[model samples]
Target: MLSLRTRFTALLIISVVLVLVIAAVITAWLLRKPPEVMYDRVLAEKAEFALLLLRADPLAAQTLHITIQEKPAKDRIDQDRTDNILAEGRRQGYTADVVVLKSFNPHRWDIAIRLDDGRWAYLDFPDPAPFPYLPLAAYLALVAIGMTGIATYVSNVMMRPLRILDETIAKIRPDGIIHELPETGPMEVRTTAKTINRLATRLNAAVSSRMRMIAAAGHDMRTPMTRMRLRAEFVVDGDDRQSWLKDLDELDHIADSAIRLVREEISPAAQEQVSLDAVLRSVAEEISETDLPVEQGAIKPVLVKGAPFALKRALRNLVVNAATHGLGARVSLSRYGGEAVLTIMDSGPGIPQDLLGRVFEPFFRVDQARRQIVPGAGLGLAISQEIIESHGGTITIVNRREGGLLQTVRLPLCKPEQD
Candidate 1:
């Protein structure tokens, strides 16, 4: 199937062709009628010939042995007669008008005369003859050919800017870094390229600043957390000490999660192709050894260009999240079309429809009241989504009809040559 842009371009080309055809048709219609002056000249020439023949020898007029018949005016002349006269005229090398009159009222006889000879001679007089529809048809064909050539050239030239725009947009990274585009082409295209470059630069700077601030805050919180842990250890009551320890642990988790989010935001460029099936199988095996009730299915080696560590971390997060929230989690890996799919399904209660969209948001646990029970900062899905998107893929959640929640990760497959 063609993309929207390609279909639209094709429509444009077709429209141009249609317009050319319509214009050609209109031109042919306008040139349909023959010149009236040519007919009058033919009639005058025929009358003059009769008078000349009479003056040469009045008796010869009666001996001429030619018949003058009365008939209705035809829309077109008889092809056979026209051809014969035209041939005779050409052989005689004489330009004469052969007019076929429908009737000579009782006064004079009407006649048909053939005029000049060659292709151009047909243009001299408009009686339908020798290649009747040829001139108009030829003219239309020529116009169509010229118009098609012009339209094709113009369409190609006009599409170059759009192609450049598509390529430039494709190269933009989610990290928000902007690269300068080639400032070439029409004025409008150049202006658009410049504007996009400026916007990308601003976005890059803003995201960088945010990531730095988050990282710095996480770094700054470590000392206070350490100090709090120390003070809690000094508490006399065991329960109080345990409470303080739990609080410190929560704080540490928060700091770590924040740092991880920041690092993911500024993730380094992916360099190698990683086999996703192998990564999933490894995660499944590790979980199984721990007796987590996780099962692996139909694992196949599917390679994709990405940061291997990040991808592994993302897959691990999904598997762990499923096992933690829903018991008897099952991990499955497969390939469909040109994409690699990793699905994690759990037998636990599925998420509410309204919260499905928000599940991937950082720190947005579904059961706020039972946040502690879930044992997470609510950044697992968020991180996983980021990782998949960075690798030019998608992560989605679907509620199973039978029961439970399904986490689906789709990654574009890397070509063998690319690997």
Candidate 2:
């Protein structure tokens, strides 16, 4: 499909060309030649004048471009035209026979009249012809080129406002925040920019409100959670007490994870060059100490610009999620193109295809029954995604063909000076 600007330009050029063609047709009609009767009348008058000159003085008439000849030229004669001219001349009261001689060029013809001295008088008057092909074609081509340039310029000028709007919208950050646009340009453009700025203001307010609410809710829950923990310690039955403590622990984990997720979204961390390979090794060793099935594989030196603690936390969440849910996780770090790629592969049954998209949603569990066994609030992946994205990185999870889940995280590699 043609873009709006291209279509607009084409439409304008086509309309202009159509108008030019119609005007040209009307102009040609108005400036066209006189009818054949008028032409014949005029030719007869000129022929009679030439005959009079030839009869008066043949030598003087030849000097005046009226030649007296004993015989007509050998060029082919147009018999019909010659008869018509002779008839017209007789009708004008001239007692003379005239012949129309055809010239070698198709566009030209001459007239011959019988004079009183028995000599033929030749009058050379070429017929009017249309404009030549090459010059006309060149003129039309120049007109087309000029029209195209003018159309393109007008299209770009008209579409400038929309282009500005599109570019401003594209610059929106991953956190759903867009900066205010400069309210400048034409009236319509200024109005549009002003409206967008107001919208961005409201959007930022909404986002801030939501983050504050989450943080407040998480903080408020900790109080009740602590009271519940204190009360659960007094339960007489051992199994009942253990279950209560476990439930309370889960609630505590949920509140802490919620607070952390909000923090990751709201806070902008200072970036510094961090060795991603070293971080991966540390996270693997730490998880291994807890007896989690985390095996460190190929680790290459890759430097990325991000907060050291935040990057480590994001990586740890991913590694833990894989090892806990997918049986064992094989962690590796490598440089691919301009990015540092950290991949975690596991061996357990992969997530169902139907539920893959929902994995990134907070507190979304593939199997709710595994809540007691896995010991998570199901916000691990969500937190990891938020943190990675905040650092201008991406994290993706997919089911492996060989039976397991694969988690891949990519961050832009830092330049040499940053190292």
Candidate 3:
């Protein structure tokens, strides 16, 4: 399907051209033979005047004896065609009922008129082409060019509002920033913009509501979670008690992560210009301090608009996840096109193809049995994704073909992707 602007512009051009062509055809049809008929009428009148002069003087009629053919001169002036020509000349107010069309040369007219005095008069006159052909062709060419210019101007006027609406929609975000489109165009355009704004408003409301609910639930669970932890301390020193303590600890961590996710969603740190290279390096240094085999590649300082703390947390999550599961990590930062890209490659056994997607789901673990060994509530990737997306970015993880997993994060260098 064509876009709105393209469709409208095409239709406008076609309609104007079609109208011009149809109007020209109709005008030509109505005007086809009138000019030729008028010329024939004038010829008959001139021939009659000459006959009248000869009738006034009998000697002159014999002296000027002009031959008149009763039969047509040739096939070019047959009886039927001659009759039709005579009828047209009479219709144009000429006394041509008794006039005979004798011959029609290329640029000459020859007609015979029967006089009131029982004499025949033949008149010969020069005839040029019926209409101004070359001039009219030039005129039509100018008309076509003018029509094309008008069509383009009208297309721009009709589609200006839609262009503005599209550009505004492209900058939409979930960060409570609602850019209102101009509602001052045609009625349909204004209505469309209003509908989009209303949808954005409802989306913001829904997100805020979810964040509040999640934050409230996590906060309310903290008291009971602490009480449960305190109660676990009294259990006998055995495997069962140890398992109970571990489960409690996991629950507390999950509840804390829930609140953290809600906070990041609802009130992300204010966006500011920050060095993307610095953020990645900071996360790499912290991971290296823990004796993890984390390598930070040479990175050029790239500036982007985002919340520094939230950005760092997301980078750290990817780095830590790689170090934990992939055995080691290599972090690199670069600018690609209009975006800043951070890549984390790990050298562990790659995640199963089927489980790579589920790894980002909250509480989803690729290797469930490994949970007992590597302690985490499984919210790292989920939280990281939410944070990156909030800052107008995307995070993706795919297994490396060689032996490990690769995670790539791309953040827009300019205004975030709101659409």
Per-candidate TM vs. native? 0.70, 0.84, 0.70
lDDT of 3 by residue, 1-419 (tens): 88887788778778877877787777667646456566656665666566667568756755767664353445534465456556765676655343445454767776666766555566667775555546666776788788878877888777876776677767866445567666666787788788877876787788788878877888898899789778877888778778888988887888888888877767878889988888888889998999888988868668889988988888888899999888999888887777888889988989898888787788888888988888887889988988998987888899888889989998888634221
**Which sections of candidate 2 miss by over 4 Å?**
1-3, 10-65, 73-96, 102-107, 416-419
Between prediction 1 and prediction 2, the one with superior lDDT is 2
Q: Which stretches of candidate 1 lie over 4 Å from their true place?
A: 1-30, 33-135, 152-166, 269-278, 288-291, 301-308, 335-339, 412-419
Residue pairs in collision within model 3: 172-418, 326-348
Separate clash counts for every candidate: 8, 0, 2
Cα lDDT tens digits, model 1, 101-182, are 3332433334553322211111122343333357666776787667666665666666666766777778877555667887
Local distance difference test scores for all models: 0.71, 0.84, 0.76
lDDT order of candidates, best first? Answer: 2, 3, 1
lDDT for 7 in candidate 3 is 80
**Cα RMSD of predicted structure 2:** 3.9
Total backbone collisions, model 1? 8
